[model samples]
Target: MKQRNGSIQQSKLKQAEKLLQRYEMDTWLILTREGSDPSMPLLIGVRSVHQAAIFIRQDGQHLALTSVSDKGNYEGTGLFSKVVVYEDSMEEVFQELFQELSPAKLALNFSASDHLCDGLTQGLFLWLEDVIGAESLSSLEISSEKMLKELRSLKTEQEIERIQQAVDLTTDIYDAVFSQMACGMTEIEIGQLFVEEMKKRDVCNGLGNPYDPPLVCAVRNGLAHRKPSHYQTRPGDIVIIDFSLKYQDYVSDIARTCYMLKPGEEAPPEDIQRAFDTAIEAITQSIYELVPGKKGFEVDQVGRKVIEAAGYPTIRHSVGHQVGRATHDGGTILGPQRIPPRPEVEGVIQPGEVYAVEPTVIQDDGLPCILVEENVLVTNDAPIILSKRQTELVTIKKNQVI
Candidate 1:
């Protein structure tokens, strides 16, 4: 794709070339059949019923081998530089072509540690060996994962703008939720309101396949991620409205907390205030430490120490996770604080990455859970918090006009 003017295709190809050089990959291969490889949607933006292989070379060349039927699909996008079509025998043609563009090493979409990277099916793996022969197979490595994580984590300017729009929409949806929320409203009712508002703006889930429902959990003492239920939200209840929106093929994971107050109440109870403050502090510390060259766990430690020092139970989840096309995006996560056995990715943090910083605290009065999650993008300097920070708790006034 030789288009200028900051097109999405330009961004994708630009990143692909950088990734090739960054990882020193000779050729990156993506093979799929019947859409078995979920990564195709992110990599190529389309799937094929017939078998196909897209090759990205270190020399900034993109080549595709596909059935005649799928040729137009890729060619239409202008993503690949060359297209080789096969009518009867794909194996015969691919093997001959593979010899001509001989690469020292080939990266396949397979990784044992990460499921998102493991898109190559067993049938395809076997088929590849049969088609390419043992010599070509000897040069194959499942290093696409390393490049994939890099590709997904490094957001282009266009992609960052799309993500910001999604976050803005999600923020607006939460604002509507707090505005209309009232005492004695069932969780299902409020959850429905969220869905209705998002639908009005045509916001979809961040994940593409199999639609996801909005999360509106009303819990008194503990925090949980669950579907909205029939449980009616009562006065003084702390509600966690976890919501995300898909805008321009990007998604946002934003969680906002609201407290239902009795009529004429001016401020929240001291216990609730303390919980919100502590959670905010955790988020603040994590954001401060979110810089390149630091380990992910080091950032996690800052958040966990602040929460635990305040005499609250540490969250049972990671301090933060990468957020992008998917809610739980790929690569280096801000590993859990105060949790045993760290993940390998906790070791490093990179610039041009985005993460969702979420921390939960059980209210001091033993009545509610206060959790605040925000999206942030790591820069060469300080991390940029994408969503508007929830500085004050949302108040629900019963029968009060907005």
Candidate 2:
């Protein structure tokens, strides 16, 4: 479905106003030069080549201060209440806007934890200080981390629909590729099949890297994010395929495990079955705890505990992460608190936020790790599973050939 950008921008601006009130900030000042801040496109749906400042206020007023070249871009949107264009110097106009707004607690797009919120450059920050002077710089004490996190994380209805479309497309591609799988095919060859299918659909890789192969790993390979290798798939090998595809600007990330059976074997070995089941159980229990208002680490603990109880090694990575514009979209992370705990782990989960929950079960023996990742949407009630959940391990028959 094609998204209506106009409606989305209007909704976003309204949400920004509410977030401003929640954070007790007067204005959200986003400074950009040559499209520096990534949030600018998200906030204003426009990119500026020259220096620009977007002021979104708590009173639902929006203003844009930009070079004359980019003034039409902001005005065309009609989302901003005022568009102030400057030709020679932005200092005078910027100063005038600041004085008129008199934001006692100005929030800037800088964060200590979330990278998405840290778009202001060090040079621009120093320049802003010089423009506003010391006393006024003190008023720029607030960080737009938490507020921006919510603004981006809480997906609107249109966004959710767009993401759902991406998930469906990825799931279909997985099915087509798995159905065509055969024993003795090299990992690279199998990955090529996925590339071919994605080309037919005209969708790009979710990671946006042409070299980023859908991590196809045979039994001997470890659970590391690497390109597909020349290792050939053989009988009795457990193959894991971690794949993602981008639809529109949203992304879908899902992983599936496949077992290549030996001649005349009806099922996979007992150990393989046990490991896969353990991973599935971990994902199931963790998803149940993924309710709104819960901390990211709390959801992570549920999966970690389940994996440990099943006699597996402690997982090295987080159970899940926020999924949206980017595969590893920056926001609340479902992970453990380490020696120096991540501030993002303490971030609260909100309704409308989608997470890619991947609880992995690693084997010390020569068995492959079982990671059945699912894209889930957090709602007021039960979490909605966006991708088709992989329950049983996909088995490739000995007779099957590519």
Candidate 3:
């Protein structure tokens, strides 16, 4: 575990240096206290209880200015080349370090667009302004969004492996719970079965409340994100489960569609199968566009075109979003350009990013909308499917359920 942690730290440090050089950033400053910044663990390998300021210069210099109480946390990792501890005031040390670097463009963690890059709080910002004077602080480019988008969104080999494990476990749980599903089961009951299985594995929900992980929706519920209700699933109803599970701090997002078969019916109606097929094709075509250097919105258009050309209403949500530490891991979004927070969708895709591509088919018929989500990893050659793809509808019979 220690060796793996070191590898992650080394890999991230190399990536950060490359980004700093590419962006012409002279220095990258990270300030956190009492675990204030969520990105600290990813950037520094450990969260500090006391105040700390980590500086990374484009020339490959690494330094940490931390309180004496929390000196070992940063020093123990061997990540920083130098560790300076201050017992009283950090202003003198911080100012001295800034002057020593004499950075032309200092990058700070603050952004109007992305929360991942906006970890520096308002109070901390004010403290820096006081320490360095407002004129000097304001002159430097403070927003690290451009650099952080690449740093955080791009997953390392270890990160991808953890996400894949989470995906595998989630699909296994689905397989077990689906076999147990039967007629006369309420939507909530079916959801509970998933929760029970999750307990057996000792994992938590990837996104929302743990007790209510999967969003169980029947044909009558449409494609809403509401909690599972007392509504009982009947024969010939399409059941969609939007499920996710967190394993070792990584999360997987996958949605599966199941058709409850009537006694005589061996398969779903023609229209339902057609809708499912279209959704599957949309996922297949969109994943092909998930290569590095492609724009997020450009990849989104491929899936949108597939779904729209199939005579269904345009998908209401983005075809895909990044999935990592958080469900909406806040990097490039595979969505339309006009969507609010346009910068997210407009960002360029990079290798090592994992995305959950979900395309929804709106139905005018009595059936509900069909949705199938798959988690994919972006690579230089081709995108890899981390989750087992839901190609065909999962059929459940009243009596055959075990």
Candidate 4:
């Protein structure tokens, strides 16, 4: 399916406004240059402004301060509400805003823990501090996390549509790979093929685009995170393809492993098959126990226990993480480490939140590892799988010969 840009739902904006109010912040400012870096995702949804300093004040005022040279570029974008062209200094613009709004507390993007809040560089922050002056700067606080997290975690109808399209396209690519997969194909060849198909489908949209395609193919029996190499696939080898695509800035991650077979070969090594089955069980258990009120660590333990009970090594990574603009979008993760018993995460698994439940397991011998991942959307009762999950091990043969 051809992917298109999705609009940000007004409901999400309202939700954000409510969240800001809850945080007790009177005004929020999203100040950035060119609206590219950390603000790109948010600005992309904006319908007005261009080449300007974008500001979304607390009183619901949207201001765009830009240079005359680039005013035309943003004027037609329909992203900003008001445009202010600055030929020299932005001091006047700042002064006017300060006097008009006179906000008690101004929220700036600067979080020590979250990368999303750190989008405002040190230099730009200094400039903003100077612009606000000593008194206003003191009133200005760094607590944009609430706004950033709420904006990203809550998806709009349009954003959901775009993400669904990306998920469908990824499923199609997987089907195509399954049809032409062979035992002798090298890992690089497989990865390149996936990339070619993504481009043909025009799936490049948000971060890690054409340069770092979401689809990653790796052929390592035991190494889960190894980069794709030129190593040729052999019979009985376990091949894994871990990939995702960013649709309208949101991300979807999926992974599947296939077993190659020699001519006349009916099955994989008994041990490998056992490991694969165990991994699948872990995933199933994890999904079954996942719910709105449960802690992330609790869900992770369900999966971890399954693998350990099967006499397999525990997965080094978390069971899964929240998926959004960035692959590892901000919010609580479904892992043992992040989801501790005490001081639990604040939010629940809302219906709109998207996640990846990837359960991994390593066999005792450490030769072959099994991993299965799928994107899911939380519902009132059960989570719905966005990408098709691999139920059985895929078998690829050297040729069609007898």
- Top lDDT prediction, candidate number: 2
Model 3: lDDT of residue 239: 90
Question: Residue 327's C-alpha lDDT in candidate 4?
Answer: 69
- Give the per-residue Cα lDDT of candidate 4 at 80: 55
Report lDDT (CA) for all predictions.
0.79, 0.87, 0.86, 0.68
Could you give candidate 1's per-residue lDDT for residues 324-392 as a string of tens digits? 778887778787633565443464788778889987775444465777899999899889999999988
What is the C-alpha local distance difference test score of candidate 3? 0.86
TM-score of each candidate structure, all chains considered together: 0.91, 0.94, 0.91, 0.87
Residue 61, model 1: lDDT of: 75
Model 1: runs farther than 4 Å from truth? Answer: 1-6, 134-136, 207-212, 337-344, 362-366
Question: Which regions of candidate 2 deviate over 4 angstroms?
Answer: 1-3, 398-402
- Which candidate do you rate higher for TM-score, 1 or 4? 1
> Candidate 1: minimum summed lDDT over ten consecutive residues — where?
1-10
Q: Write the number of the candidate with greater lDDT, choosing between 1 and 2.
A: 2
Per-candidate clashes, comma-separated: 1, 0, 0, 11
Better of 2 and 4 by lDDT: 2
lDDT by residue for model 4 (1-402), tens: 112332353344456567667888777766666453474455444322332455655545556677776677556555556777877777787678667777777777767666765677776777777876766687566567767766776666776666677777777878877787677878877777777777787675333555353333433534645556778877767777777776555666777888888666787889788988998898888888667777677788899999899887787888877776666776656776543342224345566777788879754444778778887777678977788788888877786211
**True-structure Cα RMSD, model 3:** 2.4
Query: What's the C-alpha lDDT at position 126 in model 1?
Result: 87
Question: In candidate 2, what residue range of length 10 has the lowest lDDT sum?
Answer: 1-10
lDDT for position 192 in model 3: 93
